[model samples]
Target: MATHVLIIGGGIAGLNAAKSLGDAAGITVTIVDRQNHHLFQPLLYQVAMAGLSPADIAAPIRSILSGFSNIHVLQGEARSIKLDCACVEFDFGVLHYDYLVIACGATHSYFGHAEWEEFAPGLKTVAQATEIRRRVLAAFEQAERIEEPDEQKKYLTFVIVGGGPTGVELAGAIGEMSRYTLARDFRRINPRLTRVILVEAGPRILPMFSEEQAGRAARDLEKLGVQIWTSSIVTNVDANGVEMGDERIQTATALWAAGTEASEIGRSNGMPVDGRGRVIVEPDLSIADHSNVFVAGDQACFTHQTDRPLQGTAPVALQQGRFIGKTIVQELSGKPRTQFQFFDKGQMATIGRSRAIVEIGRFKFAGWFAWVTWLIVHIYYLTGFKNRFFVVLQWAWSYMTFRRGARLIVEKEWRMNQLESEEMLVDTTDDMPR
Candidate 1:
């Protein structure tokens, strides 16, 4: 009988593992995930900022793995793992496996304040991105209708908590949208007056990058009209606004790009996990005392030469995925399994259009050249050719016209409320600047 390998989570790690084991003798791979599609998470901020559609970054898992006859894709969430029986239980049924791979990713963490989630939604999934998009567009529309300046200011004020890559990117995008994209679209209020504040608890933004790079990024953000508030810790959040220290800033839209915790699977099934709920794996990426069970991706707490755990990046996940697959194949072929080694390629984050910072090994650079490099690297790694082509076209058009095509407010109730309000809706077609 062939060895039945069950891989949980269709993320980068899981997908890569399935592909690596394709057509291998005496082995069959089954990939199970909660979502039917594989999402390119690095570009999720663009979708939230109305720069790109969801379809441009997500591809169906079945379509991606259809060419491999040895692989089977299952659309289901794994509820629990029976270690003794070597089977995973889902809502529909259970499947036994000779070996199990868990690559479930992470989610937003509210830092012991779960109630704040409703007021400040984090960008993790497509639904969350669209919800944020709705809130942002709704706030602008409401601000246009309100005659009171104080009320309008509240609506125009946007707060993004956290100064990491996600927060910085979001603040920059909002600033650009207000200053450039929507500047000439409004008649009653100037969108250029919109205030975008990036609040960071740490002393500097982009702690992962060097102090020089972080300073440059901050300067670029300020140039784009984004306010930076470092060493500011958010104490409370509500429908009105966020409370930091002794000050309260009134705003209708508050976004959370703060810390993250591992998925529920990391903490369940008696798996050994760290403080952040990531599965603590052995040197070979296997669970302690359970050789047949393995963990990868953001959920795996891997410590190489550094004192801290590895950052939850796509490169780490991809390398670990390939390592785990190769290790399994070698062991099955009566060869010794090899220890996992991570090759540090580099890290890069885009501040806004035509601006970015990149660090590779001992070399670090910033500005337009880095931005071009960032664009090329991301486009090269994008999953599907169609997505890559559409993304490039959209980016080129937006760069030339300074307009975002995906700035569509999808929610119906919000639009209905704005239309029914007492304030007259200005004719957008006539008011738009030619």
Candidate 2:
């Protein structure tokens, strides 16, 4: 009988695992994910900023793995895992597996303040990105319609919480959009007067990068009209604005890019998980007392070297996925399994067009060269050829024209229904109380 290998989550890790184990003898791979498409998350900020469409960075999971006959892609969510029976329970049915790999990935963490999510949205999935785009574009539209200067200023103000890469990138994009993209478009309100504030609790933005790089990024952002506030924590967030310490800034739009917690699957199944809810796995990426079960990507707390855990990056997930696939093949072939060792291949973050920071080993640089490098690297990693081509072309056009191609404010019916529901609730409360 062939070995039934079940992989959960169709992110980078799961896709790479399935691809690595393609056409393997005596092995069949089954990959399951709630999302039907695989999203390239690194450039998700661009989508939210209207630089690229969701389709530009996403590809159907089935289409990507269709070449492999032994691999099957299932669009379903994994609800539970039965360790004794080695079966995964879903809404539809259960899937029995000889080996299992969990890489469900992470979501935005509001640091115990879930209510903030209503006001400050996070960029994670396509829906979230589109919603952010709508909110951002709508702010400008609202500003244009409002006759009062103070109200228009409030609508023009954009606050970004978290100062990490996502925060920095988003702030820069908004700055560019205000100063350049929407500058000439708006008549009543000058988009150039838009205030883009980036708030970071840490001493510096892009804490993952070196201090020098972070400083350079700050300077680059300032050139684009972005105000950076370091050592400032967002104490509260609401529909009106964000509060940091004793300071309160009134705004209509707020974007969150702070922290992330692991998927629910990592916390469940009796697996030992860390404080962040990432499954604590062995050196071989397998859960304790369950060698057949493995975890990878953001969901796994892998601390192979020293006490610090590995950062949940795409490269780490990709390498871990490949390692898991190879290890499974070796085990089936009666070969010894080896421990996973991560190779640090440096990091890069783009501040805006023609500006970025790159750090690799002892070498670090920031400028247009780094920005070009960032573009090349991201375009190269994109899934399909068409996606890569279109991204490059769109970026080139935007770079030359200072115009965003995907700036449509998409309004869903759910939001309209939600507003109506809120109004009804308010009316009922008013009739009952005062």
Candidate achieving the largest lDDT: 2
Q: What Cα-based lDDT does every candidate model obtain?
A: 0.91, 0.93
Over the full model, what C-alpha lDDT does candidate 2 score relative to the true structure?
A: 0.93
lDDT of 1 by residue, 20-139 (tens): 888888999999999999988899989999999999989999999999898999999889999988999997799999989999999999999999999999998988998898899889
Off by over 4 Å in 1: 412-434
Candidate 1 Cα lDDT to native: 0.91
Q: In model 2, what are the clashing residue pairs, if there are any?
A: none
Number of clashing pairs per prediction, in order: 0, 0
> Model 1 reaches what TM-score against the true structure?
0.94
